[model samples]
Target: MPIISVTVGVALLLVLMMVFKLNAFVSLLIVGLFVGVLEGMSPLEAMESVEKGLGGTLGHLTIIIIFGAILGKLMTDSGGAQRIATTLIHSFGEKRVQSAAVITAAIVGIALFFETGVVVLIPLVFTIATAARVPVLYIGMPVIAALITMHGFVPPHPGPTAVASVFGANIGLTMILGIIIAIPAFILGGPVYTKFFKKESLEIEIPKGLFNPKEFKEEELPKFGISLFTALLPVILIALQTIVQIVAPESPIAPVTNFIGDANVALLISVLVAIFTFGLNLGKKMPEIMQSLSEAVSGIALILLIIAAGGAFKQVLIDSHIDKYISDIMAGSTLSPLILTWLIAAILRIAVGSATVAGMTAAGIAAPLVAATGASPELMVLAAGAGSVTFSHVNDAGFWIYKEYFNLTIGQTIKTWSVMVTIISIVGLAGVLILDMFI
Candidate 1:
């Protein structure tokens, strides 16, 4: 089959799944089979490829994502996120809730994965918006926007990490660029946009039992300072490792860099801290602590499954040589890898309704092109991350979450959340392109 035919077929398959409401996992599996057969593989070979792809990809990411989800759930359920938000809001003052929302979201994003972060913070967002007598969108957009920015651009989060790994980017450089891009993107998509949304005055009843404010009774809640430190410990350690490696290449810290700042190590430390701060110190029993941990991890089952399926889809694309063919075709074009990465990611994101999938698939397809052209791996990764976050629609769970939570019509959700996401995507791509010029 012609490469164009394969591309169109794959595109159509995605659209049908997303638009016609087919299951994404099933769609991906079917698309993979179709692509494999069309590419001349035998039926048996295609089925084997599906299994191999799913197993291999899940093998790499399952533990990391599952653990990350658990850590996030612990923090959230234990009121750690509330501690951060309330403290920040109080410190920033009511007039600057927008700024506070953005900061909290960024911090939470660094600590938690995208969906986990959203789930954790949405309650506090509602509380704050209510107290301020503003539309929920006013508060919600800034927080979610900040989370999206960090999830796309920062490390320790799976999207950027996956992109960095695929592109051979320096984790340190990617982190640096991610922060730089994140600040501006957050401001644009967040506080600034919040002002506009506030004017619309959409009311949403705060969900009951979202967070038990009583849970934070003076003696029950961890000290705000301790909770903040515990929340940030992993990110701080990872950033320290990245900085040391970049600045002191031969330093003694080199040996321990991976050990101290590795995802597993950082998360382990956070989990331990959570036990002490939220469980032991809070007078909870050992059994309760264990239950909390298990519950937190279990909440992430759907996220893990979706991510695993995405990985499987990516592997299938690789096995079919579609990635290589696309790389070859784009290699001769004048399009910069940065722009190309973003565009491909955006297209896939809009088509598939999963930013992680879009990022992973785009990175896989663009990796070969980056190698062929000697493009900066860091820029390529950022571009792919940016692209993966373009336009959100009804197909995207985030879109519906925002719409229902904020009580917005679909139009309003698009006008606000969708627009903010598009801005993040575009600004992120621009940031990568500008950085490319200098680096």
Candidate 2:
């Protein structure tokens, strides 16, 4: 009965968002209350479930998202992103501009959120497309593929990091494994997928105001190395902690490593460094830099709420004993926990169209399997994350973002963007299974 209620609840969510065009945050909260009632909770009890879910999820995510946002905003505002793109493009040259764009995308994707990455980089992508005398999709596809893969699989990108928290996966280990898995997936989704598309399909007129051909003067941009460092600092710090804990668990320096290497602390330090490297040192005023931080925080208000709502929705399932219903079925099945988690997330992604919501809800249902089956939580995070990007269609904002920006038809978006995401999803699961054999 609980499972049946949850199934109807998901269907209702799709109707609220798709048919009635409700906001995702509001829809999720409504669905949370609906599911709770269906599972036999009192109104007060259901409201409490939603509150605990919202508070628990936001408590972990807010600081990390804030610092990450500031770091990314600074990188974009001070020309650090430009510096990396231009230098990489030049290094690889016009002949390999696609390679350069995708590389820049992968690196920048590590810092910026998916939507932010798209808006910030699309102009640069168009500029690169023009200078290189190529179709926008030639470079755009690979760039988008890289960014999407990172957003789906990598930490500090909200989707992956949020899911990682739900699964209690180590952020550091998740990032390491995420990057390892994301590379080949991106290659397939990016470079390989581009080759398979028809030339006519890839061609597009630049959207009027999205193209900015004026380059930032070389003197205006930050140095490539510093730009790279500031963007990657959080990763470096967290990863070093993970490594040190493993290699030298008893090392006196482990204490120091743990302190500085925490995901929050690391990002905080990176933000401070970026304020200097990407802000004041670039000749921008302190107030201007602070203003950028304010803007960064403001931009993510809706996204943060959506994630919090997802958390609430997940909490409702757990409180209602519905997670046990699903977990019981999963435990008795012949399926691997990893694959099953992916499948649940993939289905939710298709129905709901938000990776964070899909991954969070899937984790809630599958997390017990991690302990029951002894599968690695890190791999489950990756599996759920990978599945979260399974199919991007009309429901997915990313699909429309791709379709409109590159002027592709709905059919073309399916042939390209949707198919490419599926490719990434499969490759990601394969990579996770392979890693499981070793780790």
Candidate 3:
């Protein structure tokens, strides 16, 4: 069965990486091919799927990460990152650093794509952790948890927005409800969960080349307002798009918002803005700015490859028709439509490695159940949204991104990134169930 093969494939992948220590990119490639052939594809067809997956994923991710990395690199070298870090540390103090990270992520993540938020905000994680004398995971995990929670549960994010549309849920109401549900979920999953970790979770090396966490003295740092603006420009631009789409969908300026608010375009604009704000305005030369861009691209070359390979593995599983198999099996279930949709989306999330893909696919199965089971369409949307990010593991690009950016091994990622997402998932479900009891 495809499910059995997929399970075996994931186990073998961990064995290859954790036991034998193969390069992650190569390890993913090997397993993608292995799983494809095991599921009955010929070797040549599997190779083509892998190539297509790599191309498709890179096509979208490359420019975004390139700009994001450059933005991060400029902030890192110019002490913009330090300024933000210092402000955060001073405002929140060392003990509450993770709280600061969570709040920052929540604000930016409301509009920014999760990947964009990660690249932009993750640099500050290094700075904060270093300045506060804490582990990178301590600050970083909560940041991602908040971002991922919003990505999975809230509207304007592709996954939940698309799922809401399919369910005919009121987008505005769904968003309000989502935010209400998200608070406790991220609080427990992010800050509280990190606090319960063993002392060793407190130790992590900042990833080399990706960021510099220099603790610059106050005089050397740029003004805090400009640094914060530089980091938040993308959020503002993207949020404008969503606002226009909802408030004035047919406005003449909608076309303009759509253009600039595209993630790639927004990041590019942010980079140019950063060039001036963090670079030229600071009296740095063009060559120095260009040099920072070069270093940023170089730092992520390996990270990009690992992300593509993850996409490849996901493509191979997708090609094997595992989602169809699972859907067919669950079609006759009589569970609560909310819980059933959540289960299907959660399983598909583990199977497909993309929350949007998982949520949309689950929508196809649960769309009819809205009428059949008498569940509220809004709650059903929230429930499916919850499940779409459950148990991120080897098949997920997000899992690899977290692993690479935070410089954690598979074991550490499972313990931190993986577990944190699961916590958010469960909280979302329970919260939805509680809300369902009333309305």
Q: Work out the TM-score per prediction.
A: 0.90, 0.96, 0.63
Model 2: per-residue Cα lDDT over 1-439, one tens digit each: 7779988988898899878989989999999999999999998999999999999999999988888888998998888988898889999989999999999999999999888888788998888989988888889989999999999999898888888887789999999999999999999988998998787778888777655543677788899999999999998999999999989989999999998998999999999999999988888899899999999999988889988998898899989988778767766778899998999899989987888878877887787787677889999999999999999889889999988878778998998899999999999999999999998
The models' CA-based lDDT, in order, is 0.76, 0.90, 0.78
Candidate 3: global Cα-lDDT?
A: 0.78
Candidate 2 local distance difference test against the native: 0.90
Ranking by TM-score: 2, 1, 3
Candidate 2: list runs displaced more than 4 Å: 212-215
Q: In terms of TM-score, which candidate is stronger, 1 or 2?
A: 2
TM-score of 1: 0.90
104 Cα displacement, candidate 3 (Å)? 5.2
RMSD of each: 2.7, 1.7, 7.4
* Cα lDDT tens digits for candidate 3, 279-359: 998888999889988987887687667666766776676676654554455467666778988998898778657676567
